[model samples]
Target: MDAFYASVEQLDHPEWRGKPLVVGGNEARGVVAAASYEARKFGIHSAMSSALAAKKCPHLIFARPRFERYKEISLQIRDIFYEYTDLVEPLSLDEAFLDVTENKVGLKSAILIARQIRAKIKEKTGLNASAGVSYNKFLAKTASDLNKPNGQAVILPEEAEAFLEKLPIGKFFGIGKVTAEKMQKLGIHNGKDLKEYSLQFLTKKFGKSGLHYYNIVRGIHLSEVQPHRVRKSLSAENTFEKDLISLQEMEAHFYPIFEEVVRRIEKSGIKGRTVTVKIKFSDFSQQTRSKTLEQYPNADQLWEVGLELLRQEEIPKPVRLLGLGISNLNLTEEQVYFGEQLKIPFHISNGKG
Candidate 1:
């Protein structure tokens, strides 16, 4: 999917096509959920403040998100994926990992399957999708973004090493801003530099994650494409237009967020034993306080824990954002059964895992 939410909006409303569009709340505190390529040319992107987005592109069109419609389209796309392979790992509403190694169509070429999948999606939904075909999930996901709307890229086993060597460390999947900066300080600007570090040295510097970096740079990732990945946590956060200077203001914002998280928990039919309160200061520093109960907490119980965590903050600062989350999740019996049924043996990788 390309610019999923904004693209969907453009598809349904023909007049908005080729114009800079943003899909999200048009409020003072609103954030950009999605932006069209036209909007991107103005330096607008998802997670940016809607106010700032408008400042960047004065004519940026704003539309409220239609998640229900997006979910409907997502299901349609997933159905298309199932026509080829049962091993589909959905990362979000618009992206997924499909292991088509032993597809129902008996396709020997993953690249062909990717092309056909994109073609079918466009045929069914009147939308464009980009795809990447590779031997492992990391390369596949990385390559998927190499091209823009309605394009496809394939990274063969023979080309993997050279392809990775020159790639920027920041562009690698799972590497964040903080981690990339740390790597740069250590003279690791690209895959070639990252590969120079020994596994033991990397582990010593970055803990367990160092091993992942070491192997990934060398084009080795053993993690299987898990289709039935479970949700480990659920959360909801809000960034305020103005920093909250008083405890009263923080409490007022916290309750609505708490309710929203509870609503999602109930809707998902999952509960967690741990409750956490996340606070971000005006300076962008963050802190989280968590407490784990003996059993999964109900909404009321979770709220009590959340309030306690907020009150326990030793040194309060003007807060820019506040969030409530629950973890240590337990799935329902139905979910457990579904997971069991979805579990499958890993497809043998053509490249080093």
Candidate 2:
């Protein structure tokens, strides 16, 4: 899918097509959940403050996010994936990795499979889709973004090494801005530079993740497309329009987030022992505190642990955002106990794991 949320908005509302439209946010508050290509041209993007987005493009149109609609379309797309391969691993509503090594259609060429998939998507959903055909997940995920807005790219095994050698380290999949900056300080600006470091040196510098970086640069990724990937955590967060000055005010806002996390955990029929509180200050710096129980907690226990974590925070500055999360999940098929139904608003639901 290309510019998924914004694209869906355009698909349903033809008048907005080809215009500079954003899916989530307002000029005064909130953040951009998705941006159209027209909006992107003006430097607007997902996670950008709506205020800044409006300043960049004064005429930009904003639409409230429609998550339920997006999920409906996502299911439709997943059904399409099932037509070709059962080994489809969805990374998000907009993206997935498919192992067509043994597909239902008996298609042998991955490139053709990609093209066919994109065509089918356009035909069924009236949306353009981009794809990347490669020998492994890392390369496929990386290549998927090379061409944008309804395009496809392929990296054959023969071309993988040389192509990666010329690729910038920052462009590598899973490498964040901070890590890229650290790599640059160590004179590793490209794949070729990264390949020169010893596995021992990388492990010392990066811990367990060093092996991943080392293998990926050499085009040696071996991970498979896992269709039933288990979620490790459930969380909900809110960014305030204005900074909160008191702990009382912060707690007032955090209650819903705390409840939302518990609601999701129970809804999934899964239990987790650890509850974490995440706090972001006015300066954009952040901190997290967590508590773990020997046994799965009920609603009251979860709330108490979360509240304790938040109350323990030494107020260093005005708070900009607060979040609550649960992790250390137990994946067994057991009924999780969450005392009773919450009193949250019927329309106010947002939790992601």
Candidate 3:
């Protein structure tokens, strides 16, 4: 599912196809949730400010997000996955890790399974999919992006070492922009550079994450594909067109977001004991406050807690965004939460899938 939300918009509205399109946001405010490849030519991308996106491409067309449609397509794709193997670990609405080692159809080549899956997806949904075939999740996830829109690539186990050596540190799955910069300042620039540091040295420098970095660069990720992973948390947030100036104003905006959270909680039939509120100031600073209770709180109580957190502090500047979420879920720890950005395939897992 390449450029998923934007692609869906293009699919349902034929005239929009092959043209610059975006989902969510407006020229005046909000953020680009997804951008079509045509839009990408102008350097528009997800999380970029809408004002900047419009500045980049004055002709850019913005569509309000239709999450229900995206979820419908995602479920259709997942049904196709279940046909191949029950060992499907969905990383997001558009991408998943499929352990097809002993698939229902008995296909030995993970590459073929990946292709057939992509073909079925295209056939059924009228949208394209890409796949990355490899022995483990890290390389497979990495390889999935090598080709764009309706393409697939593979990485044999033997080639992973050489491939990783040349990979940029910033491209590593678990590492982020700030951490990658920190690594660069330490004279670590790529997988090869990262491999030079000892585990003890890395742990001392990065705490628990040091071990993760040390192993991933060496192609040693041990986490298995968790097919039954539960969602860890659910949250909703919105950026303002204009800065909100008062506590009364903040509470007014806050209720709808909390309503969304409740809507989802009821839809999923999942409950959590924690309520968290997030505030982003106009200056680009952010804060989050959480309250954990003995049981799941009702809407009124959650709203009360949300308002309490919003008023607990006096702001130095007006707010640009408001958010609310819940955690301490009843589900087990084996879980993967949906992300703003994510991917992958695999008839392969590190083990027998």
Candidate 4:
């Protein structure tokens, strides 16, 4: 699923193929959900501000995401995957980790299974799919992207070390812009360079992720293809268009996100004990203010506690990003009483000076 949302749009609308298409809101505050390869040529990317994307590519054709259609297609793909193995762990609508160790089809080769699955996906959905076959999840995930838009790539266990040795560090999972910069600073420009450092050294520098880097360098990643991992939390955070110095401004901005989170909580039927407010300064320093309530909460009460936390924070600098998260979920009978209290109209504690 290369450029998944944009690719879906292109598949459904043939005329948009080979052209710059952006799937997201085309308004002032909207962000790019996906960008077609053509759009990527112009430096447009997903999660970028749609307004900024348009500025980058004046001819960008923007379309709002059709999540229902994507979901339907995803289900169809999952069904196809079940023909091979039940050990399918979906990473997203377009990508998954499949454990073909003991496949139902008794296919001697995972590469052949990958190819057959890709073909079936194209035939059933009238769209292209890329497949990757390897000895493990890390290599398989990397192999999948080697070829895109109806492509397949394979990595044998014997070739794993060589494959990683030549690979760039940036291509590794969990090595984003920040980590890449730090790696480069440490003379770790690629897999070969990364392998030079001892595991202890990496772990000391990067904590838990350093161990992952060490294993990946040796082509020894042991992470399993877990099926349908239960979601522990659902939250959204946003960086403001402009920085805020005052609590009043923060409160006004938090209002909508708070309401939206509550709506989401109700819809998902998730009860959380802890509500956290994340704040980032213009200098990029970050801090969190949180509260653990006596009972589980719905949207209204969640926001009330969230605002309370925001009021207690000292504004040492202009705030750049504001985020809200609910965790330590209460998925039991106690949740019902908490919901009732939240729904009951009452005065909210502003927690502001």
Mind giving the per-residue lDDT tens digits that candidate 1 earns over 76-165?
A: 999999999888888888999999889999989999999999999999999999998899999999999999788999888899989999
Give a tens-digit lDDT track for model 2, residues 98-156. 99999999979999989998998899999999998899999998889889878989998
* Model 4 weakest 10-residue run by lDDT: 336-345
In model 2, the clashing pairs are none
Task: Report the C-alpha lDDT of model 3 over 209-269, residue by residue, as the tens digit.
Answer: 9999888887888878779776778888877667899888888887778888888778777
- C-alpha lDDT values of all predictions: 0.84, 0.84, 0.84, 0.79
* Ten residues in sequence with the least summed lDDT for candidate 3: 341-350
Q: lDDT score of model 2? A: 0.84
Off by over 4 Å in 3: 332-353
What order do candidates take by TM-score, descending? 3, 2, 1, 4
Superior by lDDT: candidate 1 or candidate 4: 1
TM-score of 2: 0.90
Q: Which stretches of candidate 2 lie over 4 Å from their true place?
A: 333-353
- C-alpha TM-scores of all predictions: 0.88, 0.90, 0.91, 0.82
Please state the error at residue 261 of candidate 3 in Å: 2.8
